[model samples]
Target: MPRPARTTPSRRALLGSAAVLSLALGGLAACSTSEETQAAAQSTAGGSSTYPLTLTSPFGETTLEEKPEKVAVVSSVDLDIALSLGVVPVISPLYGEAELDPWETTALEGLGESDLTTYDSTDGVDYEAIAAAAPDVILATSGWTLDEDYEQLSKIAPIVSFQGADGLTGMTWAERTAEAGKALDLAAKAQEVVDGVAAKFEAAAAAHPEFAGRTYTYAVIHPEQITYESYDGSDTSFFERLGFTLPAAASRFSAGNQAVSRENVDVLDADVLLVGYPFGDEGLLTRSALESDALFQQVPAVAGKHYAVVDDLVASPLAYPTPLSEVWVLDQLVPVLATAVAGS
Candidate 1:
């Protein structure tokens, strides 16, 4: 995912470009006056927070000696949040780099930043590689093995582990953005990012009033496993932000987050059935594979051609919808879903 190495642009320069993207892309005409106006507005807005910012994690409190300069993020969520704030990390997790959605590439190119250093962390933390990067801060909002490695990582730089007090759930998009803001001393810019995305969601929901009160269900159909995983339906779900809700009948399956057998696949019934394939597992679960299954064929939504199957690459971002991924995905997904709602 890393392009060729070039001189790393300073964060301040990237910050200006990011601000320009936000305003110019947000329905305003591009002009010198408009660009200068945003720059002037952000001079006061972007630096409102004071540092030696002290942030807490389950492991311990890590205090920034001053605002962090070189950021190293370890998860896609953290990477997206940092990019939203215009800081291209010195390093990020390797899997995180592989999962760079298109929106993230746009953000990186917008900042004129590239060739990020990343280490494979599939098994555990690569403490040596991370230490070698010598980051001003490590944004581990969704990192792994932190309980064991937090103290070790702290030796390299202050680790901003997930804001989740329990050290399990990690931070939401807003929380991560806000926390990263505090560490970077860009609290006002962070809030603007949060508010800006919230406005986009609101606008989407307004545009798709028909999405309101729609009943839906989500699952991963594993042909190899021969089962369907039902994600717990939530009233306050990401889909809910776009005015969709899980079906009441689906609530029974949601409680267990269980794998419904092919025989019992009728339980996935809903006005809209949103399906996902595991990245490699897509080969196992083909359209014909489902058609050959007699019982799976009877599922109401599928029978009615009212199901939308999202490719895993596209669905990966929604696994933890950050500010960057959600906007692009919504634009692409809504039309397909609206068609499903219309029953062809």
Candidate 2:
């Protein structure tokens, strides 16, 4: 039997302030707050009841005695969330590809190139580099932060790492937005951002009733290996929220993604297919090869031309969903789907 259909719940209802903080602080021991830390927390806590916030992550609980002015983000989504919440970090690391994604480019607009420092963190977090940025608080909420990395970063500033069992991926975009809001003391604004994007999804669904009840799958083509990896509904939560459904054939995989050889390409039978590739000529060539293959052509989405090719920049934001990235994806994704399912 196929896996049961996944349910998308409201992050706010599921992770209330107390629950979220408790889950985050579950494994860590309580420690005494220093005088300097207490002073900073009191000053930055502003007038809100949630001030002097204590954020729990995989590493431990980090209590912020005050608002963090010079913030540094290890993950792109964290950085984007910070910017969306009107808090620009002193340093924001690149998301694997070694450059800013399209959403980041738009978010960083109006600020000088030097205003936000950028660096590569593909291998691991650079302790010295991030320490040099001198952030009052470090946001590693959506990155691959190991315990040792957290230990070192903590020495520089209070660090907030990923929460829940799935780490970064466990938290929905809404949850991440809410967490960022709480951390930065912009809870109201964060809710506004989440509601706005949700409104956009509702509008898109209403505009394109054709999208309802349709199944879709997103895949990354690896032409050289004659294999393509299919992503789970969690990875395409935004699409699912916009009224699309995931095919059971593609959703049964345990890893939320599965690699299928060319011989099994028929498994990816969906009303719409969203293909992604790395940026540059190599990715283009790979996508082209997959598009031309006789095996892939046999797939329903390919046979009917109901597919869209998304490059790294466009796909990055979706991979790490944020308020800004959600808006960006809807703006680009809705039209593509509309066109793909037009005559069907």
Q: Pick the candidate with the highest TM-score.
A: 1
Clashing pairs in 2: 24-56, 41-65, 41-66, 44-67
lDDT of 1 by residue, 160-212 (tens): 77765644453477877787777777788789888988888899889888889
In model 1, how large is the Cα lDDT of residue 125?
Answer: 65
Clashing pairs in 1: none
lDDT agreement of model 2 with the native: 0.62
| Model 2 spans > 4 angstroms off | 1-49, 94-97, 110-114, 119-123, 223-233, 279-285
Task: Name model 1 segments beyond 4 Å from true.
Answer: 1-45, 95-99, 120-123, 165-167, 223-236, 255-257, 279-285
Task: Give the C-alpha miss distance for residue 272 in model 1, angstroms.
Answer: 0.9
For candidate 2, lDDT tens digit of each residue in 1-344?
A: 11111122111111212112101101111222233432333343343426577878777777888876677777666776776765666666542323344565565453322234555553457788888888888877766554557778888888766777776657776788777777766677778778888898998899999999988777654333322334553455687777888787765654523666667767776888777754223332366666787888888788898877764545545554678778887888888888767634
Q: Give the TM-score of candidate 2.
A: 0.75
The Cα local distance difference test for each model comes to 0.64, 0.62
